[model samples]
Target: MSSFRVKGGLKLKGEITPQGAKNEALQILCAVLLTEEKVTINKIPNIRDVNKLIELLADMGVKVEKVGPESYTFQADEVDLNYLDTQDFLKKASALRGSVMILGPLLARFGTGRLSKPGGDKIGRRRLDTHFVGFQKLGAKFEYDSKQEIYKIDGTNLKGTYMLLDEASVTGTANILMAAVMAEGQTTIYNAACEPYLQQLCDMLNRMGAKITGVGSNLLNIEGVEKLNGTEHTLLPDMIEIGSFIGLAAMTKSEITIKNVQVEKLGIIPETFRRMGIKLEIKGDDIYIPSQEHYEIETFIDGSILTIADAIWPGFTPDLLSIVLVTATQAKGTVLVHQKMFESRLFFVDKLIDMGAQIILCDPHRATVIGLDRKYPLRGIRMTSPDIRAGVSLLIAALSAEGTSVIDNIEQIDRGYQYIDQRLNALGADIVRID
Candidate 1:
């Protein structure tokens, strides 16, 4: 395994371009299975998760070719559905949650799909009931073997109907959307996840001749079509990375510019950061954050304590709560962070607390952080990453600490972020990869 050795107290400056969204790229790659013609995807991030998905595609007899640095052409003229039942495929597929998305397209096209239990961040119990329930609504039947942890879904001629997801799961929404595109009739998805990732998926499906309305809303109306053609699409820039860079700039007192931020698609992210008094200048598609001496946390109108929480689309993203919590440590005030979606995600705050952060872990789901405000720079300490966001947040904290710090279990970070060390090195961060 590789680790990151970082020397803190460096002010990062320069312009860094955000890579393509990992979440969107994974689903988009799976969407290729819906067609036999060649589909070219531009701006695909070179991350471990994407590479794994590509390998899975190749294992199923789909031809995937790299046309450019961050581009791929996929043609699935003959997919080997039996590959889905292999041990090798199941082991790799269970490493990431996006693996579950293949169930929808596979079932719709082949009338059957077998998938092992999917895995990602072990934040909480992310049940697939919504996904299986939605699939059942589309005329699919599901059977699971407890001992093997394998799920089998079978259906014929998926007919569109109204589906009300129990919760707003991003992958669940995307899986159903991909299946409903080629169904027999109209499918109405209510309370669907409307995050930017889902929006990008919908737009790409539309470009391929799928009639989907409500791109950025909760109620999605998908008119099932008989067939879909191949088309070229570009993935959106990573908003989570944008939020991470904002935290990095604030923590290190650095001035950095992030390019191609897709300003219109950053729903409530910029505003939420602005609540921490981080000023941003949007120049066309770029975001500029000036060097900061101190950050101020916004309070309620009645002078009470302010709490920043995450909700569904149009609300703050739960994926960014870790970065936001880490950023608040360098700000000048206190803020309550409530992450409702995941249970154990807040457990990593103990590492920051060991670094001299004034954080009070209220419970498994909430934390109250009081900024040290440069009064005491966090001392470098050895830590292990628990998940993707926590891994990167620890790296950021290590980079802003007083001495050299070693972060192990960096494979978690590598799963999502593309060339993270190289990108941070380009921005003047002193980070090295060691085995």
Candidate 2:
């Protein structure tokens, strides 16, 4: 397990560009299987999870070519359906949470898809019921082999139907939308996920011949097409990473400019950071965050304690809550971080507490952070990364801390961020990868 030896208290300057959106990459890659023509994708982030999916597609007989830096052309015309039965395929598919998305395109085009229980962050229980149930509603036969921990789906004659989702799950909505695009009739999905990435996927599909209306709304109407053609798609900058950089700038008192951040697509991210007292200016498509010695958390209009919580689209993203929590450690006031989606994500607060942050773990779903106001800077200590978001959160904490900190299991961090240490180092951070 590789570790990161981070020297803390260094102020970072200059500009950093966020890589392609990881969440969108997973959906876009899976969409490549829906067409036989060449689909050229640009801005592909060179990260572990995305690369693993690409490798898996190659193993399944998809012809992949690197056209340029951060660009790829994929043709899935000769995908080997037989490979799904192989142990190698099962092992690889089960290891990536994003692999579950392939089931939709497979079942839609080829009428068969197999997958073992998918793996990802152990934040909490992320059930696959929405995907399977939506498939079943569209005339797909689903079966789960508990002994083998595998899912088998067959959708030879899928007919579109109207259904209301129990939860507005992003991946679930994307999976069902992909399948429904090839169904026999019109498919109306209510309470769907309207995230910017999902909208990008919808737009890309529309360009490829799928008729999807309600582009940025909760109600999505997909008119099934006979076949989809290949189209070019460019991924948006990762909003989560942009949010992380904003928090990093404030926590370490750095003046960093994040370039080409797609400010409009960021939703409530910039405003949320501003609510935490971070001063950032939006220059066209970029975000410029200035260094500050003190940032104060905002209170409610009624003079109540400020509570930052995650909601569906248009609300604050849950992925950045960890960064917000860590950033609040050096702010001027207290804020309650309520992680509504996952219960276990707040467990990382103990590590921050160990670093001298005044945080009270209210429960599994919430944390109350009493800002130290930078009066006493966090002292670095050795720690282990539990998941991807938590790992970055710890890294940010380490960068703002005093003295050197050793973080184990940095592979978790690498799975999401591309060359995080190298990029931060270029901006004056002292992060060394101890292999």
Candidate 3:
């Protein structure tokens, strides 16, 4: 097992470029399967989950060539359908939830897709009902082997039909949209996920001859095409990482610049930080966070304690809530952080409390953080990372603490973060990756 050994109480300086969007890359990478021609993708994050998906594609007969450190070219000229039916393929696909998306492309192009129960962060109930039900709307048959926990989807006669998603699930919408792109007739998706990830996927598909409109809205209309051609796409900077850097700089009182962040696409992320009274300057695609002795949490307009909550796209992303919650521990005022989307996310705050932060876990989805006002710096303690976001939050807390800290189960962090230890080391962080 890999662990992160962090020495706390050090100010991190310098700038680091944000990695490519992990969520977006997952959907976009699966999109390569929609065409047989060569697709060149740049800005692909070299993380465990994404790399695993690329390896899975290679196993399924896609020609994957590493053209650059963060770039790849994929050609699905000869997909091995029989390979998908193997136990080996099932074992590989079960390692990450992104693998569930292959079902859409596989069924769309080859009329059948089989997969094992995909694994990912155990944050909450991340159901795939929306994805399977959407496929059923497009003339697909969905079956499950309860014994093996496997899914078999067949879309031999997929025809376009309208679908209003139960929720604006990011992965579910992307999967169904990919399947609909080449199906017969038209497909109208109401309440579609309008996150940048889905928008990028639609843009790439449209460039490949698929007629899709409503790029940045909850409503999407996709016209089926005979096939999608090869296309090139580049990923935007990861907003979650940018937010994490902002929180890191605040908690550690360090001057840090996050390079090349697309400020436009980071809808409510910056403002959310501002609401916490954190000082930040947005300079033409970069975020400059000045070191501060103390950052205060703001009150509501009617003079109530501030509350930060998560919602769908155009709202505060759920991914950054963990970072914000940890940063709030050292701020000057108390604030209530309500993680409405997931139940178990707020549970990690107990770990922060163990590190000398004053936080009240009101429920599974909400917490009231009473800031320490920088009076008592947290002392490092041994801890285990629960999930991807929480893992990073603990690391930030450990860095802000006053002693040495060891965080176990760091592979959870590796699944999303690419070369995090090496990247932070360049910024003067004393983080040693140990096995």
TM-score of each: 0.98, 0.99, 0.99
RMSD (CA, Å), each prediction: 0.9, 0.6, 0.8
In candidate 2 the C-alpha lDDT for residue 406 amounts to: 99
Better of 2 and 3 by lDDT: 2
Stronger candidate by TM-score (1 vs 3): 3
lDDT of 1 by residue, 194-295 (tens): 998899889988988899998899999999887788999999998899999998898999999999999999988888899998988888989999999988
**Best-fitting candidate, measured by lDDT?**
2
Evaluate model 1: give its lDDT.
Answer: 0.91
Query: lDDT by residue for model 2 over 351-394, one digit each (tens)?
Result: 99999999999899999999999999999999999999999999
The C-alpha stretches of model 3 lying farther than 4 A from their native spots are none
> Considering lDDT, where higher is better, how would the candidates rank from best to worst?
2, 3, 1
Rank the models by TM-score, top first. 2, 3, 1
Candidate 3: TM-score? 0.99
Q: How accurate locally is residue 299 in candidate 2, as Cα lDDT from 0 to 100?
A: 96
